[model samples]
Target: MSGRIDPEFLRFPFRRVADAALHRALEHGAQHAAFRFAHTLEASWRLRDGRPAGTRSTTTTGFGVRVLYDGVPGFAAATEVTAEAAASAAGRAVETALAARPLAVGRISLAPEPVHRDRTWIAPYERDPFDVPAGEITALLADYSGRLGSAVGVGHTDAMLQVARETTFYADTAGTSTLQQRVRVLPEFTAHREDPAGELVSLRTVAPSTGRGWEYLTGTGWDWDSELAELPMLLEEKAGAPAVEPGPRDLVISPTNLWLTLHESVGHATELDRALGHEAAFAGTSFATPDLLGRLWYGSPAMNVTADRTAEHGLATVGYDDEGVAAQRWDLVRAGVLTGFQTDRGSAARCGAVRSTGCSQAGAFDQQPLQRMPNVSLAADPAGPDTEGLIARVEDGLYVVGDGSWSIDSRRQDFQFTAQRFHRIRDGRLAGQVRGAAYRSTTKDFWRSLEAVGGPQTYLLCGAFHCGKGQPVQVAPAGHGSPSALFRGVDVVTTRGGAPW
Candidate 1:
């Protein structure tokens, strides 16, 4: 809502081309058609040990046309932005649809969407990252890394910043038209140390990739200075920490770590495509099959999860999905039962849904849109306690913070996750740091064991930029928000290097 679309992208005759493409598709007897022009910009910087290591920037621009001809779908994209090219792409799309009609699995039908006209929206941001001088950005990262390097007991440091801007213009035969833009940035810093015995230990910032601008790295969104100052001490403590004993125990999982759990367990598991077996080759199928909707006991009564594409600052947040469906929010799990799944127009029609949840997305203009995950988040309890209060309730448990290595089975069921840092909780207080701590549990079992969740104050929005899916492999950004949660009787394991002899 704050930033504007790139002037250069707007300078192109996108509307003229879209009108030409839509007119051609309809004149060719297509029942439905849409045109989209997209422009994307990305910049990345890396620093190691307070020195510049690498820098890169890229820009991509293109337009695509999608058409439904005689109930068969077809798509075509080209980098050329002209009225003639748009018409040509539309003709090719119709031809492709006609050629594939004989092998159609079913009559391609799209869920109905209310037409919107001449609308514009932008993701909230104060400053565009591209406008910032690269040299200035590098200097900031170096200063932060230099502080960590000068810290006692710190051996090395690494820092990086990644920023992206995306602008899109969409038009459809149904009279819906929109122009939108969004910006996102991610900053990270890690500190490393080595024990006298030559074992390595490291601590990295828990700041998640966010839908914000360059201001995020300068302390507008995260407290970088404080976190950087604390990393060295944390890394040193972890280096000498004792190993965790493997056993069933109560655990307090911080939002920093729990967000990833939500992303993998609930976010990906509840995608309609994954649940219905339409998507299997890449991330595997889901156990939350369509047949279990409204019946499967997915978690405790306190558990509630929602899939939202409208959450402010959510990495996957957008005004409209690739299918031209307006962004929406709906429940995936409510009162512990599997109630819904993230959906696109085609998937919604196939699943007997009235409308999509607006999950369709394309990583780039040249790529076809796929049913992608949205901003799936765990709802926080309004009357629940804060993180420290949740920790106080655990008599003997482990406090896990920040996500580390993780693995999940093809069914999105059985899984194990390690943490960047762990603390032994004794008698409702953090006793000391521990190393090589991990937890393993099935998706259903893990959710069922969630006894309590922290209040809104303890909730954090965090996620990854590289959530890979689809057969051709498209990486989409998504956010997962969760509160610090207490899980009862979880199986904690001691990892390889930290095993007690």
Candidate 2:
């Protein structure tokens, strides 16, 4: 257990305001209460046509109070951190809860979790990107874009860099206090070329954002220089790639592309809120009903997926969930079976789980925390063969790398995914690059078709920093680790209706 945040970070105004808010809520007859303060710093840089185009930075700070009165929950937040304002906000929250008491559901009870005080955790990073000059970041992106345009047939290129840092403080009456810091960086670029058929083709980088600092940009998790240099060559190769003939074939899907597929299909479907029919408008409910838990076959025998809130460098890693539950991990799928669901303490208690795994999250001070996703990932098979060996065994297939556009049904049962680069395979060898390729499958069929997984060396952690769900649209950062896996007899589709390349 750890104490609150550093005194330097917690100024007099912020701490005093939060203390006042909690006291006010308690005085207003709140059975339980918690206070949170957060500060986020973010910057974005974009380059187009070998020149700096856009650069921006933003900062936001706020504090919020959550209260339970007569077993009904209420919340209120304020950007202004004055003691008087904080007390008034808490008073308002109590009033709101009392007004809604008549319509309240069952009593609110959070699952018991270990107390963690006098502890501190920070995301791994060498240099803080925020301290760097904005112009320097733009110059780096522009340099990469310039190199991409040097290709003979390449027309234009786009480069982007993003860095973000978050500081959070949590306190609850149950004797828990956690102060945490998180960092993330994302660098991406794209190159486009025109062909004789009056069509345009493009290629993009295959790297993912991570919980690191400027070190990630320079070359920590990824080799930015090498990847930047290879972009032009890969783009050229893709420009001349042939379109695939639609048919069922063996497919090797890379972590770069599988991450997003997991995001849309597996990630959202496992949310307890979605399964319990809470997310109806923003998207339809999931097919993963509570009735299917522990019974549904989610994948092949080699499949294992874990939902984690404490994986180092994972975007969702945190010391404690928004609901004051300490961070934890649990199995979502094991040996092809649905074993668990993403849950908050409330849902966990309702579902009779002994304890919650700390999946609760709120995008901002004003939003109600929900059972958000953690770093859900497919475990690599330690005994499995490597990707190259799997390719050697394939008589015919397509190797899909990186993610492009994707479409899936509202229920997350059916989907079609395109790739940034596709390599055709014939007789256990890479034939060449291919374009106009997409793989479609029902969720069950897709996972069931998975025949083999690559070894740990081929596994990569990749994910988006922004996954949107819920009304008012909360965004959470998440990552997925997976290896290149072979699927048997997946349906392939070719572009039609004069589609753009």
Candidate 3:
């Protein structure tokens, strides 16, 4: 069942503490201030060969204050939940900002945002995972693993479940106050096989991590039983499959694999911070520079993409960002041209946008918010073909599914991605499974080669729990939805020996 805000979080005197902190920061000569009280719960369980390997649970609660003094921003956090502690933290933040003002590069100016009073939002999820009995969850996972273990030629099986609940109370000097909670879970299963020659191969489930709850693992969202039953067979086939003969060939990429390509190429590249060189220390700057906006032919005319924080079941979905900017949706690429950039308050103002795109986010209460990615996704064709149809259109190519190892250049332009399974397509049909296959290309060249895309019926929402960025390192969850797509004359490579087999 869909969950409401946990009553325990409401019991915390967050509002009183936030008001006290804001009052103190303003009295300390701060231009802008924000207070965030956050509580997070995380649990992880792992199983190997039908037995529990480990299980762990963690809970953290804290509050942080951010302030701008003389155009410098500073932050401080504390685990204490008292108004006095909040005021002290705010005072310290102001002091820190004042000390750094002398050497600050430029005056901090934020984009204007309308005040939103007393707002609350909860992510769509049925059945809180934490409320479920640990024994029951473990039993289900073990049963799936046991099934896989019984498959012929299956050497071993591994399964994992990760769930998180995050609650935040945000208040700012601008009169915006919001209480938000979200739940997300990820379940994964893998089967391995080894041939007599000692060559090892494995296949993993395509079930994606999502903004769901315990129900997701209970066959509410994904078919765990069917996927688990089929994984061992797929693994067996992959182990005996021949290595791919690499060359320029057509490729039909499924949503399972294409989501990650979109994440690295379009999602990160379109962040205003990355484009303006402010985020180059951790991840390299983007090739999609601001100057190229509205002029660069980013892909084929059929290509369109959008950055959305309000997408249903999106991991990044929220009522408002850490900066109190409302969540939004906007086009980043339209008709194959660069059109927009994801932005936070400062970046939005620097980029001449009237308001932030709600891209600012922090991994936890103790961390400062950074310009992070939203749910950037490719727009599916309204009346395009299905996966089978897309494959049929390819005379000779490879059908790639499930994300595996990936490498992208600093600029997010040149890259290569391998998949969990690769099926050879010959004469407009799937020939057989192929191993050691990867596709490599420049971002623009790769997207521009898109010859067709499947319809909405084939679209899938997929994402990762850890997208690492920024100095001191922060991780954010993001989602990407894409339909099966066909690209022509792409560079297909054999990754095993760097030679065509």
Rank by lDDT (best first): 3, 1, 2
Worst 10 residues of 3 by lDDT: 492-501
TM-score of 2: 0.95
| Candidate 1, lDDT over the whole model | 0.90
Tens-digit per-residue lDDT, 1-501, candidate 3:
458988889899999999999999999999999999999999999999989999999999999999988779999999999999999999999988988988999988899999999998899898999889999999999998889989999988899999999999999998999999999998888888896568677788999999998888888778888888788878877888888888999999999999999999899999889988988888799999999999999999888998889988887778799999889999999999999999999888887888999999998899999998899989899999999999998899999999999999889999999999999999899998988889999999999998888999998889878899988999889989899999999999888875423
Candidate 1 all-Cα RMSD: 1.2
Candidate 3: list runs displaced more than 4 Å. 498-501
Candidate 1 lDDT over 1-501, as tens digits, reads 388779999899999999999999999999999898999998999999989999999999999899999889999999999999999999999999999998998897899998889889899999999999888999999999999999998989999999999999989999999898999898889988887678777899998899999889888879888888888888888888887888998999998999889989999999888898888888799999999999999999889999899999999999998888899888999978999999999899998889988898888887778999889999999999999999999899999999899999999999999989999999999998987789999999999998988899998889887789886788889999999999999999878763352
Model 2 pairs whose backbones collide = 1-116, 1-117, 2-116, 2-117, 2-118, 2-119, 3-117, 3-118
- Best of the two (2, 3) by TM-score: 3
Question: All candidates: CA RMSD in angstroms?
Answer: 1.2, 2.4, 1.1
Q: Can you give the lDDT of residue 455 in candidate 1? A: 95
Candidate with top lDDT is 3
Question: In terms of TM-score, how similar is model 1 to the real structure?
Answer: 0.98
Alpha carbon lDDT at 356, candidate 3: 92
CA shift at 322, candidate 3, in angstroms? 0.9
